[model samples]
Target: MPDPTQPRKDTRGNILFFFGVLILLLLAYHLAKELEILYVSALFAVVLMPVLHRITSWSIRGYHPSRAIAIVLLLLAAALGLILFFTIGLPPVLNDLRGFMTDLPGRIPGAVDRLKHIPLADKLGVETIASRAENTAAALGSYIFTSLPDWLTHVFDILTTIFLCIYFMLEGEHAYEFFLSLFRPPARQRLDATLRKAELKMSKWLLGQGLLMLTLGVCSLTAFGILHVRYFVLLGVLMGLFNIIPVAGGVITIAMAAGVAAIDSWQKMFGVLIFYLIYVNLENAILTPRIMRSSVNLMGLTVLVALLLGTALGGIVGALVAVPTAALISVLLEEYAVQRPSQS
Candidate 1:
């Protein structure tokens, strides 16, 4: 029998342990922003690790790249793309914006006058609506102009994230091993296996999502160009970049496109809307089913729910990684939580 002097439990020790946990929780709450950046950086590293491995494994005349070299090559390619965008693709868009801003004051009167011709103009207070829109646009412009410091801070955060992601890519294995060491052997092994499966799913997800983004971008570019939409290039780029966010991204971009088209003609706006409608249908019925379904192995409902929950919790960044995060959680749940049927 156990010694009665040992006592059934150490009440003081238990209270102290719980108090320490509460202190840690408070610290975590205060440091949430930094934690968010670290989380996102680690996630991108996990998603890209397989690609880095593939690059390292490549042989050109028996020459294989080291991990550092492979990372440099990827960074160089990304830098080149950015340089090209700044030099070529961004100029016309910038010029158009400058011209539009300059002409906005002159155009507002004519725009309001056009609205006067609408059947419900008086009842709807169209002129008042136009005045408010003008004021809103001016305020938006002023805010942007005044927010240079904030924008610079965001740029610094982005650079910090990139550097952290690179560091993670280089040292993540060691960190992962250390993390696993915190658990007992059996649990550690099980977690390692589960995380490896999740990594595979995440890498596949990045590739599949990339292809979808490119497809939508190219199609938007072609359709908008044929219809002679203003700022088609800019719109197309936005469509592709924002498509990473799923449903809301597409809706926001399409609305902007339709509004731009409406500046010229109602028919053009309808055309833009119709194109997006058809594309959404085709994507849902065909492209997504073929590409994402195979790659993610997730149901439509699961993805939607994940996206919604992620957005509610972490905004745009959360939405960006939500599917892959869900994949990771799903694998863990299957292994540790979900009930399995007994064999007959």
Candidate 2:
């Protein structure tokens, strides 16, 4: 009645606008899916950036950075090769693992018997404790054997990650520049600041983490060797690698070590547990504070939140990236808040 043709045009425009938004959202989702690989690759580069920087700088004095990087890669390959060789070829290591699993249930009652003779058993119900420990060991053994196949499948993913990491190391700078050029000047400046903050945070976190792992591994290996634990080297290496994960990793490593030690003697099992507890405390109180304070200044609550969110989104890899990503977000948001007030 008022203007039928004008109403029709308005409806058409609305429909087109909604459709365009839908298309854009679909494109964005697809891009995000593809970006997972790129994100992982970038993380690897960030972890290695400190080493890369040192190598590149040294190379500017006549040595080739490419060659230096190649050497570093070669060394890494050799280390991995050695680990594989030991894990595969060493009969004692295999035998120890098999024996530990097969005898764990039997060992628990023996430990309880020994515990009953101790002074504290009369004060606390030792029999109940022993029963629980035995049940837990059996459950753990069953879980490990059940999950082994799935764990093996993850090896393929590891290989893919390694390849992507190598590619990123080779092409990271060029890729960064290309990405920056895609944005307008103001946006590019903001993006560059975000990237730098993230990169620095990630690099420092990873390097500090690596050093912490090395320290813990060495200390653990020394303790094991002193106790004459079977497959000390293998156990140490496993602990070191798993230590990359934050809270859960130490617990898992200690539990496994204790279970394995139980096959020998309860005294040894208890010793391993005590040692790990002490080491974890030392790491948390001394080493982590000293190393990570400058890099990741987030409070414990923030870290926990980031970890939970990361685990929800992408599993272990996501968890690894979550802290730095949150830190970057925090930095950008703070900057934006300050700048907005000034602009107003």
Candidate 3:
């Protein structure tokens, strides 16, 4: 019943379609940065959807808040948290910082003098090392001044992402519909289900990551306080905040803590190192698996690869989204690409 005149397939049309897709891929590569911003904004909106839904579901005398109202409430809550931190948690740290800066010059000489007592300390050229440290600090100040414009650009990008995220949350459904319309109904439904699964897993990631950060912060505060480490408050806060950055964050903060401890005594420095080593072991062996595994179900190797690739491609923003993006990709692969025993 095949018609010879019609031909078996539209070969010309297929070739044109292939070329069109290739052009799109090239264009996407050229504008990857802008695409990344939009993708990140969309990902954030997806992750926050659960919280937004929860807020909208609350009925105040049968008057449920709209998505826009819910988003505003969430923003207000974040602002309140920042205000509280600045008011209550920051003052003691600021006071300690001021005192530390005032005493740094006096303390450095003593630290260097103490170093002289160690065997081969003079051979190591402690004074030279001290001078190098001072030079490094001056260079850091210069770098900060030079990077002001870059920092401003980053702030603008952040603001753009925030506004885009809000817009997505408010009107994402329409966009979603349009996106799905590109596919046949069967494929569209399957994708919708797969993405829903991914979203649930991604939301759980946020909760698990938050718990891990808080636990580390509390533990750092207690241990540093007991060890009488200098600027324990500030160090603890830094440890918690920097935990968001994965391996690099922990290493940097712990090294900083050890350096501060060393400024006091070798024993304190050893204590800081030992504490960090133990904490890292516990976090890796116990905490990460029990918390993150249940949330994302990703293997250690996969997560590590994702983090490396993300950080390489997008820096902090890439790293921030790496695990969740991996989760999403994993789900899609399982649905469409993976070969199950039954399918085999």
User: How well is each residue in 242-319 modelled by candidate 2, as lDDT tens digits?
Assistant: 777667677788788886676578788889998998997888899989998778787878877888898788888888
Candidate 3 per-residue lDDT, tens place, 1-344, comes to 87775543677778889999999999999999889999999988987898999999999999999988999999999899989999999998877666655556557777788889999999998999987776665465457668989888788888889999999999999998899899999999999998889888987887778788899989998999999998999889889987876677788899999888988999999999999999999998999999988778988788789889999999988888888889999999999999999999
Q: Write the residue-wise lDDT of candidate 1 on 77-125 in tens digits.
A: 9999999989998897777666555655556767677667888788998
Model 3 reaches what TM-score against the true structure?
Answer: 0.86
The pairs that clash in candidate 1 are none
lDDT score for candidate 3 against the true structure: 0.87
Q: Per-model C-alpha lDDT, please?
A: 0.85, 0.77, 0.87
Candidate 3 ranges with C-alpha deviation above 4 Å: 1-9, 91-131, 284-286
User: For model 1, where is the 10-residue window of minimal lDDT?
Assistant: 98-107
Deviation in angstroms for 93 in model 1? 2.3
Q: How good is model 1 by TM-score? A: 0.90
Candidate 2 clash pair list: none
Best by TM-score: 1
The TM-scores, one per candidate, come to 0.90, 0.73, 0.86
Q: Which structure is stronger by TM-score: 1 or 2?
A: 1
